[model samples]
Target: MTEPLWKPSTQRIAGARLSAFAQAMQARHSELEGSDYFALHNWSLAHPEAFWQGVWDFTGVQASSPPKAVLEHADQLPGASWFPGARLNFAENLLRYRDQRKALICLLENGRRRTYSYAELYREVAQLAAALRRMGVGPGDRVAGFMPNIAETVIAMLATTSLGALWSSCSPDFGISGVLDRFGQITAKVLFAADGYFYNGKTCDSLERVAGIVKAIDSLEHVIVVPVVNERPAIEGFAGKHYAEVLEATVTDIDFAQLPFDHPLYIMYSSGTTGVPKCIVHSAGGTLLQHLKEHQLMLDLGRQDVFFYFSTCGWMMWNWLVSGLASGATLLLYDGSPFAGQGRVLLDAIDEENITIFGTSAKFISALEKSGQRPRESHDLSSLKTILSTGSPLAHESFEYVYRDIKQDVCLSSISGGTDIISCFVAGSVTLPVYAGEIQAPGLGMAVDIWDEEGRSLRGDKGELVCTQPFPSCPLGFWNDPENKRFHEAYFARFDNVWAHGDYAEITDHGGFIIHGRSDAVLNPGGVRIGTAEIYRQVEQIEAVLDSVVIGQQWQDDLRVILFVVLREGLKLDEALQQRIRKTIRENTTARHVPEKIIQVTDIPRTISGKIVELAVRKIVHGESVKNTDALANPEALDLFRNLPELRS
Candidate 1:
């Protein structure tokens, strides 16, 4: 393994931001001590009550009563609810600080850009909320959207949540079946969608699919089309209103409906690896406190900083990214392919927006490196103070590439946490130094520890990443999982009470962490265990490859590496290319890195949210049945892996 490029620096927090947190507390009439980073982090883990109570104050989290006490039931893992008696509103906290500060910046793929200030956003959200109320939408009713990352999407989410309604969303790229598979389960009375979405120099229309979905879902009685990508579609058989029709004449005074703390704030669905996607319900107060801790303490996003996380409307990262609004920073939205015009479009956006905090997936960084695209060479990225990476375990070489090609003196935060919690277990810390191949620390109040296969906790060793103590962010429970069977089966079944996040990780002796890969995706070749990322790190760094997926195919009661490479457009996986891949792997990793056969494909299968589905592909190669394949972007890609002659027993 290569040494880390950047470690923690001496940069300290400023008073103005800290003062904002303090003011938020005072306005809510809550009591919290003035504690520093490390001190408060340890304190929170030790005293869970005091920790969450502090967040309730720190973020000015409004509640009707004092919880009836915070956390009545802490012993029950899945049933444990925070601030059960308190009444709060998720959107209220987000819209608390209303001023002339730039709230959101939308950069469309069609070269159209629009900026909305906090005042403007609040007005739109209020007008839309009133329209929904008039449409018979109330608390507990679900509102769904097929949208891109833009001001209209945020406004819709905020408006829906403002009415104490459950909000769920997916990107426009999701097909009719894909949308139906997810939205089918949730009872969304109102469907919000765009007339079209622009991506890769093309304007794709969603109206027909929106109409199709309206016919499919019995609960959907209304549709609202936002004119973002193209002109609004003509109203036909569907009884709905365009966004302009609802909010053109805006009302300014937005009254937030306060609901119980445990009220469902969002209805985010699972990727449905096992079966149909289950709706994961997040609470109002819980989601607010958790996101605040992540943004302020972990990421340290401030008003001076323009925060941007490259994400679609579908992913949980989009929800996480949108919370930057509560932090008073300009939330930069890029609603299209990162490589739409150029591979460096996002990097160029950072320069244009003067974004202090920039975020993207690890796959994007690797792709940039593979394409030999240098952003630093072409653009001035000095305003980029920090770079955030997630969605997959960042390869160490990708780590080196960030410092060498992206920025040197910036914090490269590789965060790990997922849909299960809606917050990070192991994430970045403002006070800590940046390490090239590792995440700096476990998030504050998150009692994260590494555990071995035996369920025994281990330090300075790689094992299943587990969180021992109960966290505020753990999903209340899966929606429609009446007996909590799926919820328990998903998380608690692994190590009883501990949260087995399904990632293989090691806490460094120096207090950093190195995530190997998804624990379930670990490859055991000839009894020697190796992370899939280990192979990808070496294989992707080569000049000849575009992207590759390494899976362990079961053969003769042993595991063999079977690699599928999608070469750079016209490039083919020739003998010389295969040899170069092998040489690169052997140099960077072990003999296990080299695959037995390198298969070529036109495209790779990914989830609607853009994550490579290796296990599904493995099942396909083994001739196993794939259920709910609608979740895959390229479901036909799985067919290429089946019945290969080289894999004959």
Candidate 2:
């Protein structure tokens, strides 16, 4: 059995919001008396309606009308309707706080910082919402943003949703085609973009990309340009108003439109590594309630906490992080490379701002460890209490690094979910123990389970991660998927009414989950199923290795594992290092997990969100056409794997 990396003390557990909520629930329900974490989780799944209602009441959700019924058609997967009689605006809940306390702290890479009080933020949102209403934006209309991670982006989203418009956005770093692929599908009426932005100490102009995108997306009526880098860039060709001019003439009061519970609040996109991106539409009530539950109960976020997640506007974490405002926590937004300032930028921000809950990716942690930067030695992170990691599976070694090198007393949680639901199915709980390389527990009211090939639920074996019951955060459906054929094929095609979440996972004996990798990219060698993350966990332990990707290649009428590595600068893939790589993988994993072909590459192709695209590379190596090259951040890297002499053998 693996020892826990960190465990909450009796005082900490008693102080957690989860413990308080559980105690309240126990007082209301006799069956919940003396329920532990696992028992409470099981009860929540069994009585989802009661549990979700409790979440609403405990969070004090601000809705215009209370729900007549908790859930309708509870047995149906995609058709389950939650809070049928409720009416609410997503922006209303987020803007509930109007005090003078700090709400948002904006930081740029070039030593620029700004702060917004809750009252100031609400006034700004009201001004923008009024401006949007004057432009004829209304309910069900789509509005898009091609901007950086800044205060204005959040303001724009809030204003749009306040007018009952569906909001969608992509980071300014996306190319013209990538932007078109997403916003083009939904036909946004208004498009907001920055003139330019700074990244990695360079000012990257967005004017040219914006020009190309505006021309491609036909439904765009108004193009609002924000002067991020330049005070006023050349907007000669485009026909629209400047963001400043629009806001300057806006009124102070906003008329927030009250919509149905299932009104479309956001349109999130798939990674689109394989093909065109799917616009997954999420509901207003569902998004608000789920975020409230995760924020207040699961994460134990509150007013005094300073919350920060390293993400671009395009990533879903940005959406997740912005919801912190609803919990009355101060949001810290940063727009630049995390590696800026030689990786000390974010660490310095933590000390300066007294960040309480720090959220970032697993890759960032590994990079920090490899950089030999021990934050605890130089920074005062005493204010930090919880560290959240996602984007990819956090390795066990990274867990050790967080406790040993970062902060030992803090809770390190490796959460896993996707843009598909816009929230996590399994996340960390403050009342639970933190184990190495394992998510603390399945989220309350989420029926997360691991299943075998025959659809039998398994406890301690690796299998598909499935959600048997319907949850509020499941997307309303995909855009342009009128018959829901695409949505059905995407999630429920694998099993009957069960959401096969495409994750190779195992429910540990401790009631935690270990997500191996995406099931589509799972490696099968000699009829033995293997996860790519299993190999990556071992291969990344070598000091000489910088990054790696593993895949199963068809060879000799049987599948064989192949490994590709991006070695550290000035290090070559010689026999000694190759032997070390193979030995490390063999000793940690099984012999079959060792790669038959150990190749070195200068780069690994990843998606724009920093996720390694193993499926796209697999298609490239097999001489198949990758359907969407625009989906990749570095598409040219695919050529490195093409026509390789080593693959011929």
Candidate 3:
């Protein structure tokens, strides 16, 4: 086994909130006398009810009615119920703090910065909640936002949830069809949108798309337009009021409606690469409890910390980032391209704002590395301590670059979870050692395990990543899935009662996890299952390669690996470069990992969230139709893969 890349010092571990929580647990429960993270995790999984109840008390979750039962039908995975008799408001807990301290700090690509104090945030939410109420938005009504990641977006969501109405949002970058696919299914009563948004130093107007969406979705009775780019966009055709006008109404206080534990709080959607996105409805209490556990205990976030995540309103990370408010930490919101000013925009924000915990995707780190931007050498990242990465698996080379080039002392947490839960199954730990290319440990109270084809548990081997127990963050159900048939087929189909998260992963010797890739995108060549990330890890190491995507092509009654490379500008894939690519893959991995064919493409298709669409590319390469090209950021990139002359050979 290799040595850990980084380990928390005695002082760091002792100062961590996780250590304090463990000590508190030891004092409360006799079985949790051990102080290590592994011991605490085991105790948590063994007694989930007591563990969750302890989290609730430790976090001081405000509730009108406490849970009569912590968990019911614990053995049933999808059927299990959590917090049986609890009545709590998700937005109220987040808005619990109303001091002079800063609650939200909004930043834009055009060097515009705004700060909202906790008290001011409360006032805005109150005003917006009043406006929404006047607009006839009641409990259980769907309220959607098609806006940028600004303070107003957060305020609107808080206001909607405060009234017990469900909230959903997508970034302005999404096209009309993508927005309609998500909001159209739920049929929201109110639509909040921005006049325009800024990206890559350019302004993109959204009124045209907003107009089309309102026309298509007949359930929208009111459209509230926020003046982001254009202060007063023409709303002559739309039946709505300006965002400022709505907040200026006569309203001073907010009345938070107490709802059941299982009441819908937010509706997250699947990637919908293959089909229409599934509207996964998450519960208020579950999202709150899970995010609190992750924020307070796992990430060790506190009132003094400043949290920043580079996310759009569409992604689930935005939802996760807002929960920092409940932790009493100041939340940072950035809207625009991270590469707007040659990648220095985000790096500058880290130093300017004294950001403590910075959250981003793996691709961003890789891009920073490829761009030859050394933040540690040029920027003052003294206040930065923890770096959280998700969206995809973090490469081992990227991990090395973090400790070597970014910061040696920081905790580089590679977290993995999806919109299905709105929280991580395996995330970082302040008390544990950080191994290269591995998540520190399974989240506390998450019974994560690796299962084989026959539903048998396995360790130290690559298999399906399965959660053997129910967690608090599980979605209530699908939006239109009346019988829960879609929900069951989505998660519980592979295993009898286990939640089969569609990821190929392995449990490491250090009690960590290494996620290979998506299980559905796993390549089976010559009857051997190979993870696409294995090839990507090697290919990305080449200096000439900017990006690459691999897929399995069916040929001669067997599958063959086909690799597509997006080379750097002014570089071409020649015979020598092909040999170098194959040599790198064969030397680092086995010969089976080498691609049978290497083709160079201009761009790779990805979703709005920056995840490469492997399955969609595979379908197009095999002369099959891609169901929804509208979900992709570069839908035209699919045309490059279709009818390729090289594939015929």
Candidate 4:
């Protein structure tokens, strides 16, 4: 029998918003009375309309007009219309709270802190929106942000969305070509950027890159630069205004535009490692409702809670984090490397800010554990109720590390979703027990399942993760993909009328989920499919291995697994270390899962959002052209894998 790492107390469960939602549903629908969480999930799928409508009501979505119908053409995956007649503003819902309570707390790498109350936040957005309106940015216009995760970035997004304009953003670290590939596709009319940003005790300037981007993208008419590392940055090369000067107008009100539920609100980009990034557009109503459900019901977040997620403007989690404001929760926005203070920056903020919900990537948690910084013994984390992990699957040892080293009582929710949906398919439930290496449940009304190649459902077996029904957060469609050709092919073509999420996953017996890796990145060695994450879990447990990336190399008449590792300083890849690595993987998984070749490298290449790019490395090893080098955080690392003598064997 497998034991759970932690379980919510009776008092905690009773106090959860999910429990209250269950009670409310039972009261409305007699058939749902006395149903457990699993039973309620099934019922939600059976009656998605009622479930979503109930969520809209429970979460108090501020809409100008109620939805006439919850769903239309429910059978079509790509074509389904949700809340067709509803009229709402995504910014209006997020900025509904107008009290004096703290709405945003901005923390920087150089030990700077800035805060804004709800009333102050509204005023800032109001002034910014007026400025954008003066610049002719209104309905259907696109505004892009090349800034860090700070209050101004959030304010810019809110101001843009308030006027029914679509907003897009990327972290300032993106190179010129990368920014051009994404923001160029959308033809953004206005750009918001920071003069520079601070990271790892260094002040990196963005003016040169922003000027380059503005010069390349012919559609940009206006540029707003926020002063970060400098009080005033020279914008002589570009036609731009200071962000502070733009907000100097005495505007005190926001004229929220009421648009259709399916109106485009955000333009997100797919990591353009293989090609030019796809510009995915998400609807306002869908994003609002989906985020609200995940926040209020799944996280049990309320006005009294302090929520924080360590993310850059480029990542989807930043979008998700900003939605916490709709729940009236205060948000902590941090801008810097997560390892600024020897990996204590984030954990220290939890104590200083009294953050109740903390979110970060799996890699950070693993690195923190390896650093031997045990927060349970060093920090006061009594206010933390939840710790969320995403970007990749959470390792089993990392799960145990959370309970053993971080906090015993907190819920460690390892969520899985991507920029495609802007929300989660499998997430944590506050009312459920915390199981090691397993996501608590498929998100409510997500209709998530694992299916084999033939589109047959599987249990306790790795397969493609699929959603058979339409959810609110599904992308409106890819920008410029007229007639929905590329959009349909991206998701629906894998399975008829199903959203193939591209993740290789399994449904555990505990009614939870275990995501192995991405289906595209799955290694096929000797005709057997192997998830890369399966190898990563075991290799990461080794003390000498700092990081690793594994891929299948096309060898003589067969495919063999190749692993590249970054070792601890002053360490070398010797026979003993290689054998020990193979032994660990072989003992935990299968002999076939062990790497055929282990090569030591200085670093592993990753995306700007901190996800390892296995496909890019594979392409480099195979002597294929990587279409966009700008998409990688460390494009130079690809040179390390090129023409390796060991792989030639």
Q: Write model 2 residue lDDT over 1-649, tens digit each, in one string.
A: 8789888899988888888888889888887756567778888987888889999999888888888999999999989999998988899889999999999999999878999999999999998888888899999999999999999999999999999999999988888888888999999999999988888899899988888998888899999998888777779667867887888344666677888889999999999878899999999989989999999888999999999999988889999999999999999999998989888999999989999999999999999999899999989899999999999999999999999999999989889999999999899987788998899999988999999999999977899999999999999999999999999999999999899999999998789999999999999888899989899999879999999888877888998888999998999999999999999999998998989999999999988788999998898888888866777778888988898899888
Query: How do all models score by TM-score?
Result: 0.93, 0.99, 0.99, 0.99
- Among all candidates shown, the one with the greatest lDDT: 4
Summing lDDT over every window of 10 consecutive residues in candidate 3, give the lowest-scoring window: 245-254
Provide the global lDDT of candidate 2 against the true structure: 0.90
**Where does candidate 2 have its weakest 10-residue lDDT segment?**
247-256
RMSD of each: 3.2, 1.0, 0.9, 0.8
Give the C-alpha miss distance for residue 457 in model 4, angstroms: 0.5
Pairs clashing in candidate 3? none
Error of 3 at 57 (Å): 0.6
In what order do the candidates fall by lDDT, top score first? 4, 3, 2, 1
**Which is the better candidate, 2 or 3, if ranked by lDDT?**
3
Angstrom error at residue 35, model 4: 4.4
Q: How much does candidate 2 score in TM-score? A: 0.99
The list of candidate 3 runs beyond 4 A from truth reads none
Q: Going through the candidates in order, what is the number of backbone clashes in each?
A: 5, 0, 0, 0
The parts of candidate 2 lying over 4 Å away from their true place are: 248-250
| Residue-level lDDT tens digits of model 4 in 421-521 | 99999999888888889999999999999999999999878999999999999998999988989898899898989999999999998899999999999
